[model samples]
Target: MDIIDENFSQDFHCLVYDNAPTHLKRTPTAPSAKKMTKNTPPVGKNWLVEVNMYDENGKQIYNSDGSYKKQHVQMSSSGFTEDGTPQSFYFEPGHEREGVFKGMAIILEERGFKGCVGRNGRLAECGDFSQGCVTAGQPDCCCRRMLYNEPDFVNVWPRLEEVANARGFAVLFLPKFHCELNFIEQCWGYAKRVYRTFPLTKKEDEMEKNIITALDSVPLETMRRCDVLDSRFRSL
Candidate 1:
């Protein structure tokens, strides 16, 4: 991103990435109901989400021993209510337990969901979330499931997209398991085939030269054809 901004400041670019887990990971502090408690926490105890600590310049802080430093922080906002009012996951400043995490029940109640709290309290999530209530056509079967289905929660962008969008670059993730849709994969294959044709060499410098030569040997016409094929697959 720094190189792009420095060399081509005026050009708009949209980067495409594979749907890998590393690329789709959200920031640790992003809102999530996966581990939220069903009711308010015990007195003097809080349920803050653990997140990596960052320094003044926004870089993650590392401990002297090399692991990342961590701290408990409130989760991000739980989106808005039906009337357009913003919802928060923690009690407001004036409350007695201010800054403490609001468990799933109260959070759902604030979003106008009734029956979230009962004599027995609600379940944090369904028994088998993916194949349970959702598959049974009961989206509101549990507090956590309902929150998970909320538009704001469902639409939260991954960190990569957030950073790219902030810098005026659009980011798109290619569909998972579809290498044919990635034109660069074809170019890499072509380079590898050319690389095998080179004479065997033991010298490091000679090996590097051979690798670069093999890559450069790929024809521009082949790249164009691969791109066209990728576009056709995408259109389908």
Candidate 2:
């Protein structure tokens, strides 16, 4: 071709690219539809859901006390009692789970987060979490066909297959270290900063609610950020 290939790097290119994201060459999943089905509207083939919880008081410290004796402190269990109830059941010297699991579960259920595939995914269970936990640990994939308990141990790809039923998202999981994919992470970070700005001595429930409110204040860059309509008119 007699055209300059450097046009892609020109200011004009940047302006065009900035205004609209490059359209995808292909749809990775689903079949083409000529008409809208009663159950199926124009939407993404997958659905996305994510849940995360944080507790600043859930800190831990370890120190060597004597020649070989090491001491460990579970700051989470030692926080306080607001409703006349303890945070966690202390077992051994260095073991404490504080309200971690329960707190996380509540957040997930409250937000209506279901098991689906994305990066670092966990299996979604119908009712009893035993199956979900098993899938989360082993995950139904070619690699590691067995089952386990920890989600970190399983390959999240299998979870992606399980998530196929959801509508409203792509097959890919949340992007790592990417601010655009999961805006909630930034919201949480911002909320944490805002909450820690002033010294606080509030009830546990109140504190949690305050942080959630702060997180909700973030505004999404919708026009440039949300997924655009697919160009179905182009026959491919």
Candidate 3:
């Protein structure tokens, strides 16, 4: 499948942007207790988690106003059952998608993605712990599900300069979780519908031919319509 279009080079800039938008089902993991208890105090239900303020030299950190700085707190968590049973487990805050993205950011930086800037105008840097730090301590209930101010790409950002200088490509990351923005997705739907019309027991070569024909059969006008719709939604 070669698409040789002179216009591709004539009009298009040598830039590319993509993201591996992974998703996970958010199953209800709400802790059992609803009210404040010994384990479920005002801050949160997570028993092992606590805020311990400290300075760069490991000394207790305090603000100029004689108050502890929440940003410099030592956060720790332990793995235990919902019933408060003791378990031998260390906290893994960067598990699952967060973990993968953090590693990807580090790898991209090492591979010449250093010094890149994001679309949001933030310099490519590792996660900023201070950005999400609380200004003051509170009980678990008051602090439960608190939103932190932080960049969305803090976990998976590669530097922009290194991408252009080292890789000679520009990147444009799309908004997260918006499939309507990608016209190819709509084209794929049309192709899939066409593919389903073929006989199920087709031979291997015939299947390949059918698949290719189905993909090519997508109307250009339909593709344009998808783009228009996407633009309309973005305007909203």
Candidate 4:
């Protein structure tokens, strides 16, 4: 937008391609850890178990002199807290039940975000998310799937479009799940491969040097090649 405003008179278009969670301004609130009770069996999914070794006398084992000896026993799915509630419970009704998506939607609506075009190609206006939406598959319920499909023009996108429009430019979004057409993905993969080639080291300074070296090693020709390849694929 800035470059076009400064150098060109004709309107320009900004095309954005995104798929990963990194692009979302705010992520969905994570579920509270499942607590384990005496009667409740161990959990299995998404839980880690940590055990501390103690001597026969029931006291925590210590190192030879003063340091405490600590070792990771194994990863377990056992319930963490006694109750289902979070250990440090900050009960945010919206975030707890519906997740951060509702909170994000509320914030956006408050800031004049009217919501985005849905898969049906209609503007899905913001609703009262303080009370969570109904689950999908029910009669007209705004379930998790629907919420995900809702248009999001709150953060980076709205700002980008606003700036571009003010400078006589149009902002376009690439089709969803079309990463193969994005040349940047190939460049990122190439960069990661280069980064992996660096010699493994423990020193922080050495690691930083290796990272910089790997990034700087990607030639401009390689970037051009990636873009050309992407164009060819798109044409095909």
What TM-score, over all chains together, does every model reach?
A: 0.88, 0.24, 0.37, 0.37
Clash pairs, model 4 backbone: 49-76
The total of clashing pairs for model 1 equals 0
TM-score of 1: 0.88
Q: Candidate 3 lDDT, tens digit per residue, 1-236?
A: 01313335344443323345332111112121112121112232233323446678979877799976653111211223334443222223664322111222222223233322233322222233233323333211121111111112112234443334354344444476777666678889999999999889648899999999999999999998987786677557
Runs in model 4 deviating more than 4 A are 3-13, 19-159, 234-236
Give the winner by lDDT.
Answer: 1
lDDT of candidate 3 at residue 25, scale 0 to 100: 15
What would the per-residue lDDT of candidate 1 be over residues 118-140, giving only the tens digit for each residue? 65665777776867575547888
Compared with the true structure, all predictions reach lDDT values of: 0.86, 0.32, 0.42, 0.46
Off by over 4 Å in 3: 1-6, 9-18, 21-131, 135-171
Best by TM-score: 1
Please say which candidate is ahead in TM-score: 1 or 4.
1
Q: Give the candidates in order of lDDT, highest first.
A: 1, 4, 3, 2
lDDT of 4 by residue, 154-209 (tens): 12244345555576665444457888778788777887898898777899999888
Q: After superposition, how far is residue 174 of candidate 4 from its true place, in Å?
A: 2.8
Query: Which stretch of 10 consecutive residues in model 2 shows the poorest summed lDDT?
Result: 13-22
